[model samples]
Target: MGDHAPDGEPPPPEVEPAGRVITTDGLTKDYGAVLALDSLDIVVGEGVTGLVGANGAGKSTLIKILLGLLAPTRGRATVLGLDIAQHGEAIRRQVGYMPEHECLPPDVSASDFVNHLAQMSGLPRAAARERTADVLRHVGLAEERYRPMGGYSTGMKQRAKLAQALVHDPRLVFLDEPTNGLDPAARDDMLELVQRIGHDFGIAVLVTSHLLGELERVSDHVVILDSGRLLRSSATTEFLDSTGTLLIEVVGETGTQDRMGQALAAAGLPCWPQGHLIAVDTTRATTDRDVHDVIRDTACDLGVGLARLQADHRRIEDVFREGGDHVLPTS
Candidate 1:
């Protein structure tokens, strides 16, 4: 028997299954002649998993397919152990979604909008109203919940959208570019809220972003896509781990960084000046001759004060620029 009931029949009772929250196998989608998603096989567990890619990398397409808003050309997927092909409605009932584009009505107040959505999710009138208020407060829109959405700032509008998604008390949320058009502070606030949703409320979150580095702080795992293909998927810690490069900062006159770079290079250490700091290649450094000791001695010889020295960690972008087994072909 399938996970869901037959067509036109009511779905089976919703149940939270153990382990992976989402899994896809050989998922492919083509928009006419253009392939939007290639053969993608991924497993997403609990916590915040960041979906990262450049534009037109199939991030949105995958989200739509998972939500049952669009059908895949090939392969299958399951959310919370319910087949998306057979249990879309059941899956949607247990999951929340925040779309990338603006879909809010201009004249409606946030409170009313959220309340209506909560009721649609099967909450009673009183329960819907209470949830609306609770989610609005949680999203930092309690003070502006009564105002028309048209009058709300960009941050407020984003928060209102988030509030509606959470009003239903979903086990998972798919947030597509939740930090779209906000200032740095607002973006940080949104990220913090996303972290809270995953950590505090225990809601599994799948957040999409084109900006590679923005999700590093909040996401427990990251999935990278390139031109409709999976590039890499791993724990965020693995991406940010030390890259065997030592970042050395010297405190001295304006010419200090260049001088240190020259000294280190002359001392047989591969080093380069990197915007006020010098980066020393430590991949070849041996335990008998520590890279840190070499740097310290070089700085002392040049009479430059060492400001800071630490291992340079890799960023998500490095996986693209630096050739790695995890990287996919751009062509």
Candidate 2:
């Protein structure tokens, strides 16, 4: 009746195993009159995929549905070749989830809590303990593993949460706001750790955040959501490619940028002042003479030193302001 195959039957292989790690089709969720997720579709491949959106953008709701903790009102999803509708328990066993908010008990030590969770994931007692130790060390919490989590700092608590998520040695990890409340240095450390989990450990990661720029450094692909609707999903490099605009900076007198803008405008180029630099729209340039040559010659004619000239790339936030219509299918 829905886009998914019948329960107990596997969905047709929409993509090669090496290409996609997860897929969803027409996934929607509603709370009475309010729709948390509108008929959405997406594909996540191997490596670190950043899911970005502002607060109350249904990012948390999507994670819960993927983990099988919350049911979608329509559509279906698959994770690691298992149906979320029929094999949620099996899926949870193979996948690990690090929730957004704090969930640690004040009375328990990090080591013990992580160990218990590993065992609950079906690991033997001895294996769980060993795995817990390895994960704690990897997360850089070896020294404080035995201390009460109540006294731990925010960064330390976040590390503990990450340790538990890795204790089970899951094939894929869903990290929800793993860097929340972290300072700049701590956030960088967390991001580096996330990169290692995907690169060094050969595990797939789906990390979420409201910050747009932070994930650009670490994510292989990005999926942006707005009001529970898909905005854009593509490889990180695709978003950073040239947007037909070049930013030019000149060094000379105090108003060097202004001088360059005026010279370029007089040369029949569409140029304007932007802060200390001038933005030149290259879309109008003639094919015979490249835009770069035009800019360089114009600068030479004006006798102003060209400090920097490069194409202006699009940022993730541009998707919202530009109302991006590019949506990649789950298949």
Candidate 3:
């Protein structure tokens, strides 16, 4: 059944929203002496943008402020062009949120819960039921949609949460760690669904996660936060670009790589361990020590044969390197 007016007329068709999905200017939140979010100024456009940080790094706080569930101490923000402080209810009506914590009822069936939420969002009972069944099937929960959620596994529970968020056909969604407890295969499946929501359905998405490398795959843009402050913000390809570093792999005894890295470091070559290979900075060479010369000498002194030497591309982990030059993306 389709949504209809009380006068027996069909409801107005949904319109696709345009412009920036979210924007904040000097958004900050604090609890007494502790600061949770610090002066966050960012603009998120369409597609998937990953809000990445550690557990206590204000990722959740930022989302709450944007959703108008929590107030910011000293800044302004807008969601879909409406001021959060003034149009909170209106904003919530057009946005779907999947929280990080478990909030599902033990005895409620997935079908019932999603259908009820759809009705609450202003759909008629018949329309809500039809929408719920479709959304549940889209999330891969069609076979077990009627089972009580308390008996579902972690992956199944996650699918149920996703089903509810999409039942209302919101223009935007905020998914807080949708892959938190899922296995590798489940996580991949969920990420694929997230991509489909953004690209196929044309819904703006802001997904949060603690893993930088994992999000880099699905996120169009990545905004990294550290200690409640903006660390770096850029497109996904910027993170994977080449850093002008040479990867040196060696063939030797048991601890050859570690010993080689230490020796290179002592020779004033900026080198670090990347898995079993040593990554040396080609740009950080000093006048006294020729970086390439030192590496050759070190390998000869240690009696380790240099197996490979080639330019290495930057990895997401380099974002945390102590002296890395993390350049934010230009608009």
Q: In lDDT terms, which candidate is top?
A: 1
Residue-by-residue lDDT tens digits, candidate 2, 36-95: 899889999999999987787788999899889999999988888777887676667767
- What C-alpha lDDT, on a 0 to 100 scale, does residue 166 get in candidate 2? 90
Alpha-carbon RMSD of each model:
4.7, 6.1, 7.6
Which 10-residue span in candidate 3 carries the lowest summed lDDT?
A: 1-10
lDDT of 3 by residue, 50-95 (tens): 9988878899889999899998999998888777876677778888
lDDT of 1 by residue, 53-164 (tens): 8778999899999999999999999999778888788788888999988889999999999999998888889988988989999999988888899998989999998988
Candidate with more favorable, higher TM-score: 1 or 3: 1
Question: What global local distance difference test value does model 2 have?
Answer: 0.85
C-alpha lDDT score of every prediction, in listed order? 0.86, 0.85, 0.85
- When summed lDDT is taken over every stretch of 10 residues in candidate 2, the lowest stretch is 322-331
lDDT of 1: 0.86
lDDT at residue 70 of model 3 (Cα atoms): 97
Q: Write the number of the candidate with greater lDDT, choosing between 1 and 2.
A: 1
Worst 10 residues of 1 by lDDT: 322-331
